[model samples]
Target: MKPVRYTGLTIAWWLVGTPVSAIDVQHSSLVELEAAYAYKTGSWQKQEIVWRPEWVTRFDSGARLTVIGEGRFDAKDKLDPGRPDQPFRAQNTETVFPSDHIDLELREFYLDHYAGDAFVRLGKQQIVWGQADGLRVLDVINPLSYREFILPDVEHRRIPLWSALTEIPLETWTAQLVWIPDATVTESTLPGATYSLIPDPFGEGRLQVNRPDSLADSDFGLKLSTFQRGWDLSLNYLYHTIDDPLIRIDASGQQVLADYNRSHLVGGTASKPFGDLTLRSEVGLESKNRFQDSLTGEIINTEVGSYVIGLDYSGFSDWFISAQFFQTYRFTGTHDNGSSKEQVTVLIRHDAMNNALILEALGIYDLNNKDSLIQLEAEYSVSTNVVLRAGADLFFGDQSGTFGQFQEASRLSTGFTFSF
Candidate 1:
């Protein structure tokens, strides 16, 4: 069998250490191992297993080096490798392989160098942005999977999973930055992984959006946060101008929209507590790209969308809750002729027996028309970092029967996750 090209890259990275000091795993050092599992349920059942081992050592000055190796496995209930003679259901004399177990994934590699409070990390990594949950208007800079975030995507959709980060701490505050010069994905990953960095459908990088050896993009971001005894506030700014997207979405429904045609982001968050209860809030915004209209013949304005105002309450030690409302208003935007959307969400969380038993509920409302979503969830901690969660999501309004983009009028799901 042909060897993996990236495995060689990992070895080369290990050989190249920093001033922090190098350790011969055969000689000196510290090492650690970690594993994680995430699963989801629904029409599609998915699961993922991540196993990694790491070695760390100090070289000289403030420099250090770390060798990280990771393996990922995915499994599904149905996957046809080939052969019409082979049934696409069972993996037997006539069964197809599930989407969950055909992976020899390498998640990370590379060395790290740090001098003073300044740090540089290179290799496969995950870049997380946005302080809000669910909707990610301004968080388009980094790659993400809603299936992984919201439900469960046993199918791994990897992105420009490598990059660098730097941080500078100051009195009472600090600054951080992320740079992803190379944003590529493994060729063997799920079909859901791809993007047109420009977020512009009719722009450059579309064809190479998900191809490897073509990760030519970067994301710049800054955040300033501090405390004032009674409350904490943070202001964030992000600018993502990509030559090609690290992550892209493919629309399969009726109103198939092109992957985001490139966009810009900006947002912030704040938190405070009253007596025994605590409160927090966040907001984000994005400016859409301008491209050819599918129907109209002119260069119409796409529009800049914004997520606004929210509140969270955690007054009781055994209970936690949050609520947020976001709407699409006009600003530095163009597509107002018919572009319209507005939503509201509410959530509640409760804990008992040291957070062993938990309950949660979330609901979404569509102000423009008749689209609303209601979800309820409950879970019991079977062990530390492991739990059984069950829930039902209900969709109401005219947009339910429409498949694709806004498919499923109502559905139910239950699953669990384990982290170790």
Candidate 2:
């Protein structure tokens, strides 16, 4: 069977067939409905309306179940037989595609059980780590979908991992262990998506993938955390597959093969509050790192170290301010030629009108490459159970840099959510 078919079956089994022993049940449930639309500027790069429905239930025994899904429809995806440039696009049925014109997804379906000081969670779920915004340091469990870029919350963008998680509380610290039985790989971009990172991006290609779905390819992670002297600290170790693919192009340069690298990560994080300000920092080292060579499309193995430090303050006029510095160093990578790259980000948010209106702004500056991205947004509470949101994404800098590659993808967006 094809990988996409296998993935669909896996998700179906987890959503409807995963079982656990349980006792008497007292039921509580919630349902949420959400819709959104976005329009790309200048060109028909993107236009779409997305619908999402989420539901969750809890039993008296402290067992919880959740189901979340989404469907998307794009204006340009409709057929226009008269126009040469306007073509009919088929909806995507695969769960993990690089991009989507029309698509349906069961984003998360999970069961959680707790007893005494121990807990177990099974099925597909997102496990978030680290405290930095817009940058990843120790948060490597789930692959992120960047189709919508960083406009969405990290939780919304994080691809759920199908795994089992166990947690236990000891006298001095809490321990968590995660086991992924069959890992799925997510790609960076699709054929005609709005954004492109590669120079002269290809419009058509085949991706031969090497994924961790076999028994020998499963992944594992362990974390220990504790609070001491007003500081929260955690130590982590992971034996997992990298989310980003290492690409190797054929001699023809039109066909590409991507593979996952088994890697080990050792990381630590700490956070503390000083009056109205909170400080956070995390650092990690990845041994046996792998990445694709931009020019040659060859995969190379190396070692890398990454770190992030952040500060958040909320002492001024109901405004929240956050600033962070992030850096990554290549110890032995073929790419970057053993050089380091750095970036800084600042975020500001404020609420007014009795907490009915919220304003937010975020800016990211690449100190090394001089590229930047800025996002501005506002959300208003139309009603007690409904919210209206609008935002814009702007990119600036050199074409070779990260944010600058999407200079033509900047766009405005709006959304609405209703909960019951």
Candidate 3:
């Protein structure tokens, strides 16, 4: 049977087809232009422009609707080298391709309604649940896109889903429930793309992906949150298919098979502030997790626990600093991929020139692999509606490490955004 495909255009058309002649409407738009130059290849890696338009309508009964659409053009399509034959299965159904260099998509469309002390939101939207910066522990409600290899902001990398979400206030505590029917998984760069993760030692190989496409495969989660005595805390639980695929080679070693598996996740987060510093932490345990053996090509099933601790300081004027430590441990699994992994990240930001200019730096280091990534950027406000940005991404370590594998892909970039 053919796989079931969900398209954003279907929901968009349905929304537009509804009659709303007596509602209040508000509209806004933004344009972003960016380019990057690869020092290793000595060529332009990307030259892209994006336009986003948004609309919001409010009814007298307190119901609201939001719609956002995005259009992109790439003159140098190095980052998204079109996979004509396969077409990158994850987002193909929701996105439209006008040409080799142009694409259009419905970014987000949702409705917000308040019923007494409870809130309901239904449609294609993003749900975030973590406090860690540049790291994901309990934020698995939505899958991610790795087209730029985690270089873009979180808002740009996350792929929204069609879901039902509601929040209920119970005294001093709030409970959130989410039901996601969209089966879109994480999107990895294709073979010919700049940041492709698949290795082709022998030659270019075929990749076959089996995605879940039934309502029975839907995902659901629950979260309870409360604040007491200057502390913020939440408990989260989710039962869903893991977004990352487990890749294995066929017996013939000519084709790669990628499949998804289900897991039960129990996690929690806590944060508190003291004077000029804030402490934040998150912990999660996955009941069933799968990892591929590097040497034998075997898939190992095991339980995994991961945690992160972060601290943010803002004592100094016009400056903010934050640091985080993250670790993952496998309870019972083959030792080929290591039993435990450690990582650290740091971020520093400064505002200058009377808040017209800003400088920021972020660093991520893998303790086990001894590889690291450093990012530095500066932004200048040209006016109230325009902002200019420049940055550099540097990678250091061996090719076998995570960040080290992208050493050659490091580059300098500049961009601008205009909003109105």
- In terms of lDDT, which candidate is strongest? 3
Residues 320-345, model 3: lDDT tens digits: 99999999899976747679999999
Cα lDDT of model 2 overall?
Answer: 0.69
- What is candidate 1's lDDT per residue for 1-420, written digit by digit as tens? 013235334533554543224434322221222222222223443344445456555444434445544444444422212122211111110112224453333434455666566766665555555455565544444454322323322223333344566767778876667665443322221223211112344332223232222233345677676777876766667655422223332333212122223445667776677765556566666554454444543454444556655676767677777777676654533343445457777878788777788887777676766566667777888976566767665556673321112333144555665654
What's the CA RMSD for each of the models?
Answer: 8.9, 5.5, 2.9
**lDDT tens string, model 2, 208-317?**
45555534777789999999999999999988877777656665766656667788999999999999899999999988777666766566678889999999999998
Model 3 CA deviation exceeding 4 Å by range = 1-22, 83-93, 201-205, 251-253
TM-score of 2: 0.83
Better of 1 and 2 by TM-score: 2
The whole-model lDDT of each prediction reads: 0.48, 0.69, 0.84
- Model 1 CA lDDT for position 57: 54
Minimal lDDT window, size 10, model 3: 1-10
Please identify model 1 stretches exceeding 4 Å from their true place. Answer: 1-101, 107-113, 146-160, 183-216, 228-231, 241-264, 276-288, 291-299, 302-305, 330-340, 400-411, 414-420
